[model samples]
Target: MMRVGIDIGGTKTQAVALADSGEIAASVTLPTMRGEDAVLATTTSSVVALAATAGRELGEFSSIGIGIPGHVDRVGGRVRNAVNLGVRSLELGPALRERFGIPVEIDNDVTAAAAGAAHLMSLSGTVAFLNLGTGLAAGIVVDGVAWRGQAGAAGEIGHLPVDPHGLECPCGQRGCLETIASGAGLRRAWPAGGAHPGRGLVRAMESGDADARRAFEGLVSGAAGCVRILALSIDPQTIVIGGGLSRLGEPLRQALGATLREWSGTSPFIADLKLPERVQFLPENTPAAAVGAALVSRT
Candidate 1:
């Protein structure tokens, strides 16, 4: 049976249809609509359109899976505190299941992405997907299965308060890791009037600007801290980095590696683990979460 997966991101929503063999039959991306109802409507329509594009009726697909931001209550089929999508609280799984007339599975976007990455890489054992996007989070997969913790909030490393006196996060916490490690956090470090804040900051850093370098270093440190926590806590075979900041590509990895080396030089345990070597980056076009969403329905 065919499976459909939808990723509801902060700015864009993507839908993909996968055949029984795990090949993508069709996919579509649309700007995420504003407001609660519109967002739900857009997601539903996107899935339907993707199925039509594959020349298959909705009934042909056996199940649907969706990945959305913020806290999710899987059993209740409700989403809470999805600030980026502007959805405070919404009942998504039940609504979509009713509309599509199929079984639906909804999960945190980062978790879904982690599952997708594991599936695509054919990874086994423990693997952690650290998503550094508009927000920060990690998704853990054990033995090829996603682990959401008891409260379905397992990988919320973004809220792992790093600094007691740091910037306030939307989650009503001060100095959460997200404030220092995420794309949103990076932008906050830029000048108020800087054009193309992210690129501009990178350019400034490349030009030997002291302040820029400091900002960049902070990002590297935040990222390294995340890796350390994951390594010491889960010791995953691989820690895959994804999301918007992952676009920083090799540079991000290099900086992270440097920090890990610094720590490893001081601590024999860190040196033994070689956490830097375990880190990997996804290809720019691999929609692991969306793909994982499809995989979820089948599982």
Candidate 2:
């Protein structure tokens, strides 16, 4: 049976209907509204749209899965503290299941992305997905299964304090890795770049904006640090980069490689890990979280 997956984000929500063979047979995208009721309405509409796109009834799909940000109670299908989406707490799973009369599953967005990346990229063994979006986090997939850790905090590397003297994070930590590498971090550092700092970063740097250059350098270093931490801790076979900052694309990849190489030059152990070779970007335009949510439904 085809599976339906929904990815809810701060700006937009995307849903996809996946065929039995794992290909997306139908999809829909819509602006995501804020608050519990609106969010639920948006999700419901997306699923309805997907069903219409595929010319099938809602009950025809085998399952419906969701990938959402913030703290997720996977078993309970609830979301909490999803600040960007204006969601404080929501019973996402039960609401959807009741609406469609199909099984519903909820997963962390990054975790869902990990599953999608592994399947879409045809990766095996342990794979780490590092999300460098408005914030930084990671998701781990072993074989085809997600490793959410004992308390479902497995990939919260963004909150790890890297600098005690650095800026305070929303998580009540100072100098967290996310404060240096994420889109929020860039906005905090380079306020002149306006709302979306990453979009104008390269141009500002090209025009010799010292602040932009510094922000970019910090982003690269922080991202490299995340990679190093993932390599040393998880020892994954591959590290897939995703999120908003990754849109910097080739320049970001090359800079990350250069940073890793520089670290390797300083430490023999780092060189032995061959981190630069293990890093890769998520394929452009792939709705990893949405596809992953679909995959998660069966599990």
Q: Model 2 reaches what TM-score against the true structure? A: 0.97
Q: Can you tell me which runs of candidate 1 are displaced by over 4 Å?
A: 164-174, 193-196
Candidate of highest TM-score: 2
lDDT of 2 by residue, 46-114 (tens): 999898999998778989989999888888899999998999999999998888888999999999999
Against the hidden reference, what TM-scores do the models get?
0.93, 0.97
- lDDT by residue for model 1 (13-37), tens: 9999888887888999989976789
Candidate 2 all-Cα RMSD: 1.1
Write down the RMSD of candidate 1 (Cα, Å). Answer: 2.0
Cα lDDT of model 2 overall? 0.92
**Poorest lDDT segment (10 consecutive residues) of candidate 1:** 190-199
**Alpha-carbon lDDT, every model:** 0.84, 0.92
TM-score of 1: 0.93
Candidate 2: clashing pairs of residues = none
